[model samples]
Target: MSRLVQRITASIRFTPACVFPLLIGGSAIAVFLAVFLLPVYAKNNSLDRAIQDRREALERQELFAPIHARLTMQLREASSLVVGDRQDIQDTPKSPEEAVYKLSLLAEQAHRLGLLGVTPHPDSLSTQDNLAAELRLAGPFPQLRDLLITLLAQPWLHRLERLEISGGADVEEFRVGVSVRMDEGS
Candidate 1:
């Protein structure tokens, strides 16, 4: 073994056959991999980043989904409030008393809807082409729904501007702003 080691160490004649293939062919293969594979790796990383960004955007939309739906529903309600019933009433109210009477009918409708207390803001009576009054109501969701149904059934032009209902399961309170006209034509 010692003689073999000495002979191996002494026979150090460098051969280019294996060395040239390793140096030239290995470097060529490395360059080919860098050229072809680097862009593919970079493109895959960018696609991963894009997918992550889209996932985050979808999560944000899911977070705001309820709020957006509620706002959309409120806007639809306000738009539908402009629609009047088929009551063949006069074009407009000439006096506040007539407006009060009309609103009193609305109050009666509320009384049947399960709310015990109904108060009208007398100061809310404003004179434009016709008299408009605001009524404040406090009740649960069912009664409020009933009240809204009755309100739509009335042949009066209304701008249901604001409606806020807040509470837990059983009992709720209502804070709504409405402007009533004699008819949609007015």
Candidate 2:
């Protein structure tokens, strides 16, 4: 063991000629790694994180896509049903009694349009000077549609307050309510 140590130490000399070159080479290699390899690794890591974040955002958008589409379609339907503010009805009722007369006229029109189970219930006046009435009817879809169009086309300022549709496949029952605003005089 003593002789082996002697031989090894003798072969590996700490001479300046060998030591300087080894030290310079190690330092150069370290500088090369710092200047080139480390920056490349850091940039690759940042790019991978950016890609992961974008994928998560895309996944979230995909999850809510159906809900967004449904809400958009509902908004379109509601907008089509809305009455614009600038439109003026020529012969609005001046009193609740006149409003009831108008409602009776609407019931007669509904009957003529072949709507069954036509029942109109006039409600008392609300605090907002609005006279409300509910018309319950059962009919085919076409007659119901025509009645709705006719109601919209009437020469009075009214709103379709509540609409409830029920029944089976062939026939539909509708409980429709209208609110007519009476002028302040009566």
Candidate 3:
């Protein structure tokens, strides 16, 4: 094997023929890399960019996960507590006449619940398509609480926007503001 190695090394020389073949082989390798390996590298880089984009999207979703969860829970709780006739909201008021009738009916209901001096802001309905009403009530604290509970349970999707309760032991003076969407469009 040593003799063969020596003979092989001695037979090879940097002649024109030997140098010519080496140059051709090196050129062929260069051509192969330019034709195939370069495009493969570009495609690999594109895939890495796509993976980075997906990772950024996943990070954003994770960041908002708690807010999404809280909103879902609140919606579920509100849906579960509805205890009024849904039909009351089927007719969206198209004119002042209809709006007045609805307000009167609502006031009557409030009167029955020991609430008085009910007034609705018509401008609120025209401007924002929301039925905003204010009421004054002098009653026991338990009655005031019951009214608030009933308002929340109404199927019209009404919410108490603001409330002020001032009283001691016997009589409570309550000032309340409530609002509901006029219809699906509003």
Highest lDDT against the true fold, candidate: 2
Evaluate residue 48 in candidate 1 and report its C-alpha lDDT on the 0 to 100 scale. Answer: 100
lDDT tens digits, residues 135-155, model 3?
777777765664565555544
In model 2, which range of ten residues has the least summed lDDT?
81-90
Model 2: CA > 4 A from native: 1-90, 111-128
Model 3 steric clash pairs: none
- The digit string of per-residue lDDT tens for model 2 on 67-120 reads 977975564445435523423222678876677676556555654343444333
Candidate 1 ranges beyond 4 A from true positions: 1-14, 86-186
Q: What TM-score should be assigned to candidate 3?
A: 0.44
Summed backbone clashes in each candidate are 0, 0, 0
Q: How do the residues 93-183 of candidate 1 rate in per-residue lDDT, one tens digit apiece?
A: 5455666665556655554333334344566555444444555555557666756655644445455656767767776666665566654
Cand. 2 Cα-lDDT: 0.68
* Ranking of candidates on TM-score, top first: 3, 2, 1
Segments in model 3 whose C-alpha atoms lie over 4 Å from true places: 1-113, 184-186
* Predicted structure 1: lDDT: 0.61
